[model samples]
Target: MIHEIAPHVLDNQFKIQDPKPNDYCLVYNGSKSLLKKEGNGYALPTVAEIQKLGFEDFEGHYLLNIDERAFFLLAVAEDYAAPEGYEFTGNRAFRPMAPVERLGGATAAHIAHWEALNKFCGKCGNVTIRGEKERSIICPKCGNVVYPRISPVVIIAVRNGDKLLMAHNIDNPNPMLFLISGFVEVGESLEQAAHREVMEEAGVKIKNLKYFGSQPWPFSDSLIAGWTAELDGDDTIHMQAEELSEALWVKREDIPPYATDVSISCCLIENFRTGFTLPET
Candidate 1:
């Protein structure tokens, strides 16, 4: 959903291009992004402004090429202070902005996290360098290559007649309800993960597993594959106390308000509420 930027293209080719003055520069300190407040909103700085602020020494990666201009992600030192009239905010705050801005901010944050975690080779203790032909870091000594880490997760909406299953994650500080979701474990297919997550979290077996869709959730470097499944046996929910605080089924009229179009979880719930069926796979 967030990655579905129509009209505007996102080119992720690993080309060694210099930053132009007008190109967008995403400056990050730790996990927070720098944004200059403009009237009632915020805006990212240009390459020229970033250079003027003495952050030009930091190495930046080519994040995206959109509308003939490139976007670069720069990881600044934690001690770096924001210029006057600018403030640092977490990536979540960027979601309410325009589509291009929201996508750019998320992409920049993900790239920054990847770059910070892979400064040195995991196999050898030597420092790693960016790959010339691909989006990866290479180790000279051990020859180990590291790419951006994306953990695959399955988010499923369990259906039983006119009711949809939902749960509140115990680990989340926010009380927003969500569908059953979990990371895809080793040696498991997407469908298998979907079934396992539902059973683990809600203690229910699911049938008629249908592939819904997917979304690139950059908040924690996750690619969420969405699915819809029917209750196999019992309708009673045995909530996993460790993972979920509560679990319940809700009809279309009683479903709670949730996420925007930026997430596949929202799409899944909306589809079920509208009685829309996915095309045969």
Candidate 2:
């Protein structure tokens, strides 16, 4: 849903181009992004703008463009002091902005993480450089190439006649419940991952699994595949204490709305609450 910015095209094709002064600059310090304070919130700073504030030669790696406007992921220092009228905010801050900016911030964040994590070659312990022909990094010593990683995840809504399974993970800061979801492990299909995740976390089997939809979850560096399934056996939830803080079946009417619908997990839960049926899937 976050990437559904209609009429705002994203040109992700990699090209060799240096950042211009007016082009948008994306800078991050770990999990927080550096942005100039806008009217009520914040906006991305440009190369010229950051340079004017004493960050000289403020160039960055060229990322994709949105609607012909270019974006560069800037290399920033570790110790950050926000200039007047500027601040660094977490990823959630991008959610409330207009769709175009929202997508920009999230996409930039994803690339930033990829760039930060893969500073050297896995095959050879040599410093890597950006690949010119693609969105990847290359090690000169070994000629090893590394592309941005996109991990696959599965999110499923398991339903009985009148109730839907819900869970609050142990690591989640917000206590709001979510559908059964987890990363797809090695040697597993999306379907197998779905089944295993449900059983491991909720101690239940599922039937009538149907493809719901998918979303690019940039916040977690995951591409979430959504699914809908029916409970196969008992309704009693033998919750996995190590994985979840709470897991239970909530009646359709009792399932509360999630704070945002920008995720596939939220869509799965909302579909169950609305009594959706599988269309011959």
Winning candidate number (lDDT): 1
Report the lDDT tens digits of candidate 1 across residue range 79-198: 988889889887776677778877877887888778878889998889998898888889988999999999999999999999999888887666767789999999999999999899
lDDT of each: 0.84, 0.84
Off by over 4 Å in 2: 18-22, 38-41, 258-261
Model 1, stretches more than 4 Å misplaced? 38-41, 56-59, 171-174, 256-260
TM-score of each: 0.92, 0.91
* Model 2 pairs in collision: none
For model 1, which pairs clash?
Answer: none
For candidate 2, the TM-score is 0.91
Worst 10 residues of 2 by lDDT: 257-266
lDDT score, candidate 1: 0.84
TM-score quality measure for candidate 1:
0.92
How many clashing pairs in candidate 1? Answer: 0
